[model samples]
Target: MGIARQLVHRLEQWFELMGAEYAYMATDRSNEASLRLFTGRCGYSKFRTPSLLVHPVHSHRLRAPRRATVVRLGARDAERLYRSRLAHVEFFPADIGAVLGNALSRGTFLATVGGYEWGGVDRFLACPPASWAVASAWDCGGVFRLQVRGASRLRRAAAAATRALDRAAKWLRVPSVPDFFRPFAGWFVYGLAGSGGRDAAMAAEAVFASIVNMARGRAAAVAVEVAAMDPLRGRIPHWRRLSCTEDLWCMKRLGAGGGGHADGWDWARSAPGQSIFVDPREV
Candidate 1:
């Protein structure tokens, strides 16, 4: 076997030995070699196409919808809410509580408008707003930094000049390029979901914007990955220039099984779920 296939087999064997019933992976849709390695040689199948929505953090703070009330949720409360609300989502991790409570997690938050009142966590959980959204923040800054590669000298010089100008004149409000040449920190918004429809989408956008605001000064960008058909995706505020819609996730059952429903349901054969929980640890 080739080196890549051998590496994949080794990882699969290790997972299976640890009692894993399934294997999952994601790759850029443009990577033909990776697609073949995972799907053709490794027996994985095409599963979900989630878009990586990204928004650059402006020098100024971003405002959430004026009418929306954003609230940070405790880890326990966030975990409970996600369990109940996202149980139907494909590839939902079982250790979501650990993820939410991780040190790198900034916090989980929710947004609601239309006369929604804060009545304690229990009450809020019992009767969530008819139009609401929920999301959790992961400080990817703690994990790693990203830097753009293969830029021409002229483009690099222009980016540096823009940054310099923005720093020199605070009031210019120049839409300068982000610090892509240098390593930059960023935040990831995972577990993104909305109740449904237009109102819920608005609430979701507000929550996402709130998270971006929270990351101001500390992160270069804010991002979230959501299934293509997710109801709130179209409304979530993200810069088209910084977003990508071609991230593909693939999955397969391990061992002698042929993608069987080991857990009473096979996510591989299931239709596109409403959303996906992007595990921060994997990112």
Candidate 2:
């Protein structure tokens, strides 16, 4: 605790000199020590808790792949797309040029159909008024795998019970993941979206299926993050009923505020698991 406070103080001083407006950090509820240090000493406040959902690519999750006119763009084109289409998205980087310039953004993709196209994000009100979901895989084969493998004995046992129940559900012809939960390497479908009635959504789905096929043997799973309120949340396929952690966002406003307090921030009052968002590059 003492060490963290010192480190945070130093970082705050550094950022202040750099003329940064605010500093952000996130921690799950289970991390009591981290929460205390940031809130108690660092002068940060609770902003919001968003559900982080992941979709693992597998045979079962391979729903019908619709065919849409999809194009993989170059760095310059992707950067242009981010700049032109994603300005109003909440939590989006103000300087997308910096983000696109970062080495982490391996590639950019765009999907178009039915006279509509989505380059960066698919925003919706509470839920998308339309329908579409994307599929891809990531080469994230280490920590993500470790998380599930390193579960406690009790936690593993609970998973076993769930597996048995899953089998029973499948026997009754109900929707269930009969294979338990197996994982592999995969790609990610980030900033995938669509609009303008059924055809457009279907086209987006087709494009996603095509990507999934490309990742079939080369990757273990693809992961994407969506807010709970995102209409596409229900449409995106994934390991059904999967458990995930919720990260509570904490932030401190610089010189412009009341000792960097963030209690009254609009994002703080948002419903947990709602409006979860992630840039594909951060996937």
Candidate 3:
């Protein structure tokens, strides 16, 4: 039975009843049938294409440079930072505080390199470091399970062997592969932002490494989504083998609207921005 079309219609009706102005859905670019269903039949237009960057969690801890200070932000402080620094970024959520405060949320963190004191948000923002980066960690494992499909026997055996070796030798710090064959949880990085410069890139790399290190044991891996043109893309550390270069997001106006825009500004048609806020709930 062709239920997808009917489901889309019902969802749109529900959206309208909920006073939603728009609705969007994401799918892999290679999903031809999904693309056709949403774009041709459901009237959803092509929208944002962001890359999903993933890094495997290692058994060892990765530390930021001695000069850099990593701060774990409280929900209120994290909300303040996002509202002030990322308000204009695409897909910035209004209930960020709620998201940050969710049980599944690991924490929000900021990495900075300088001789500054943590007086509070005001002091940090007032005298921001030359290279600073912020990110939030969401424990996706608690929400749902993910399994990797179609892996060959050899790959699985190799992964198992590597994991065994790492377990046998704890001092080696071997990069063990996750058991993708089984349902496992992974950490999702959201609200990634940073300043501009080589130092900023280093700081971002440190932040990503730190997240991966922190996620070990609890999560099999850590992943983050960013726009192609996002400045932080080149800075964040990820494995080319594990990351997706492009993930498609399609959007449609639920109510009578002018090209999915209120004042002649379509989000789908807008140019790619430097930064993006990847909401874990949506991911």
Per-model C-alpha lDDT, please?
Answer: 0.85, 0.53, 0.83
* Error at 111, model 1, angstroms: 0.4
RMSD of each: 2.3, 7.4, 2.3
Candidate 1 per-residue C-alpha lDDT over 85-204 given as tens digits, one digit per residue, 9 for 90 to 100? 886676678999889889999998988879799776678778878898999999999989998899999999997787677668757856667778789999999988878478888888
- The 10-residue segment with the lowest total lDDT in model 1: 261-270
Per-model TM-score on C-alpha atoms: 0.90, 0.61, 0.90
lDDT digits (tens) for residues 31-59 of candidate 2: 88898888888778787665555444343
Q: Give the TM-score of candidate 2.
A: 0.61
Cα error of candidate 3 at position 204, Å: 1.6
Sort the candidates on TM-score, descending order.
1, 3, 2
**2 against 3, candidate with superior lDDT:** 3
Rank by lDDT, descending? 1, 3, 2
